[model samples]
Target: MQLANYLFFTTGCEQALAFYAACGLGEVTELKRYGRDGQPPTAAMEGKVMHARFEGPGVLFYASDNHDAEPMRGSAHILMLEDRGETARLFGQLAEGGTVTTPLGIQPWGDYYGKLTDRFGVQWMLNCRL
Candidate 1:
């Protein structure tokens, strides 16, 4: 298992992803545009971000547009991990004392990752690099 941190953006996911990339965070991978899929997206989500991934030294982050236009709140950044074994170990430890939002598995981005919030309400992200 490997893990990476995640951030959820409200609408301007593409811009945010580019900004972070410009900030020297890491190379942006899987920068997807919603309507670019060649499918008819909803009228409200024609050009939004369907998914985006970024990588930096010891950091991996993901983002997507909120289709509902709901406001993103709270501080829910994931704690990305580098090694699958380390991620699995950490997942077990955290789940033992918290809740798993997403079970570890092969994500659409072709990486193994998971999400969980510890007992203290702190969210964690685990990832295994592909």
Candidate 2:
């Protein structure tokens, strides 16, 4: 299992993905439009990313667009691990007593990843290589 850390901008997820891809980070493995799945997203979320993943070095970063769902405010961001099995274990453990923002699964970027907030309100990011 491998782990990495990252800070994703809350808004402008798509723009950020493109910028990172252009900066030689790695590649935008997945970029799904919010309203493309037949269940169209709200008009305000048309261009927003339902899910996005970017790879750099041995790291995979995940981000999502902020619709009118909720406001996320904090200064913490980290891409935890890059190992699938280990990440799964950690995600399960952390979510056991906390809240999971994103369940561990194959992300749009072709990697296994998830997000959650620990019982202490600290956010975490888990990612594993595809």
Candidate 3:
């Protein structure tokens, strides 16, 4: 079976996806804004991301907005990559405007690693083998 990461945003899933795209995180292959299929989008759901299928170099994930303001906890998505430059670039991009729990570095275990919480409060861990 193929595995994929799914993220739920309190709001701004669309904006988050845009930010991620700018950071080279991934692209949204398909996106559906929240709305009743039989009716035109209501004002409340007009700009909210209902679901988005995101795919990147070697990763796949789905994202959507909950619109209920609930907070997410107890999970951190890990990105394992082999290209040093892309890893570093993505780490820097994800770290912008967020808390860096661990600065990217060559760890004692000999892997380039880092941790951060993005502006949307999504935690991430990145490891690169170069």
Candidate 4:
């Protein structure tokens, strides 16, 4: 399975998207607004992104706006895996003797995904498109 990076923007995703696009990271391949999901954003998150994906020759970046999120610090990267089998295997290995914040399972977003803090104290996110 191939690996990709995912990002989360507690706020200011629009500006971040613009900045990265201008920096030539890649084109904005897909964008989904919160309201488009039939779940309108609150006043603070109005016009903000529910999800945005950027793609380049060897890069994939995903981001979303979180209006009520706590101040983000450090890296919030998700290690995205493309194959379900590999994702499950690696997630099992990583969760061994570690904390599983979210059990591996199918999510409404059309993927099998999970979150954990590995034994080495590193956070991880494993994903496989369904």
Candidate 5:
């Protein structure tokens, strides 16, 4: 069995994937739009991507536009907290048995930033934009 991340976007899957490629994440190997799905397209689905495969240096995932549903949450996490104490607390909790890739502290970018992988292998990123 193979495991892959699938992302659902309400719209602009193409543009989002383009941005990802620009960020050196990955490039879309194949893109299929709703209008060309061998099914009649509705006005709302005309320019939306039905499915797309993206592959890059270390990432392989699929993305699609689902006009009626909210976007799916992926393994990556970004937490923006305003409370220093709370931030530290959560950081400690997430760091329990997992590896802390980046220590939680004020970064050169002038924000409290850190990254960690939970015991379950999920990655998390925290940023307290000061």
Candidate 6:
């Protein structure tokens, strides 16, 4: 069985997408915009992301602009990296223009972990088993 993670961006898909891409999360593919398909979105939602996916090594991330839907309430996404250097780099990048709830450091479990909520209100758990 396969599982995928999806995010509903009420009004900030583009910004979040750009940020994730810049963080080297993965390649954004299959980006569909509103009005491209039947039942176009409202004017305010026009050109927004109807659906998008990010593909990386063993990763499948999905997101959409939920202009008409209820706003998302939480960030349930976590990213795990194997390399300490890469994890540190990404941790710093993700922390840019965001708040770090938990600073990156060695955990008692013999791993490195940190928590942050990005500017777009997406919480992230960065874990590295060094």
Model 3: lDDT equals 0.84
lDDT of each: 0.69, 0.65, 0.84, 0.70, 0.75, 0.84
Compute each candidate's TM-score over C-alphas. 0.50, 0.46, 0.87, 0.51, 0.57, 0.90
Residues 36-92 of candidate 3 have per-residue lDDT tens digits of 433345576666777889988876899988757555578888999888888899999
Note the residue pairs that clash in candidate 4: none
- Which is the better candidate, 3 or 5, if ranked by lDDT? 3
Per-residue C-alpha lDDT of model 6 across residues 1-104, encoded as one tens digit per residue: 88897888887888898888888887788788888865488888888998998887866889889865553356456788899998899999988998899999
Q: How does residue 86 of candidate 4 score in lDDT?
A: 72
- Candidates 4 and 6: which is better by TM-score? 6
**Weakest 10 consecutive residues of candidate 6 by summed lDDT:** 67-76
Total backbone clashes of model 5?
A: 0
- What TM-score would you give candidate 1 relative to the actual structure? 0.50
Write one digit per residue (lDDT tens) for candidate 5, span 13-87: 777677656544569999888878765677898868898999975468888888675533356756677777767
**Candidate 5: misplaced stretches above 4 Å?**
74-130
Clashing pairs in 6: none
lDDT of 1 at 72: 36
For candidate 5, give the lDDT.
Answer: 0.75
Alpha carbon lDDT at 130, candidate 3: 56
- Residue range 5-115, candidate 4, lDDT tens digits: 555566667666665555444678888887676668887777778888888754587777886554344544465767788778777776766789889999989789998
Best candidate, TM-score: 6
Better of 2 and 3 by lDDT: 3
- Candidate 2, 63-107: lDDT as tens digits: 767654343456434555656776777677656566888888998
What RMSD does model 2 have? 12.7
* Runs with alpha carbons beyond 4 Å of true place in candidate 4: 70-130
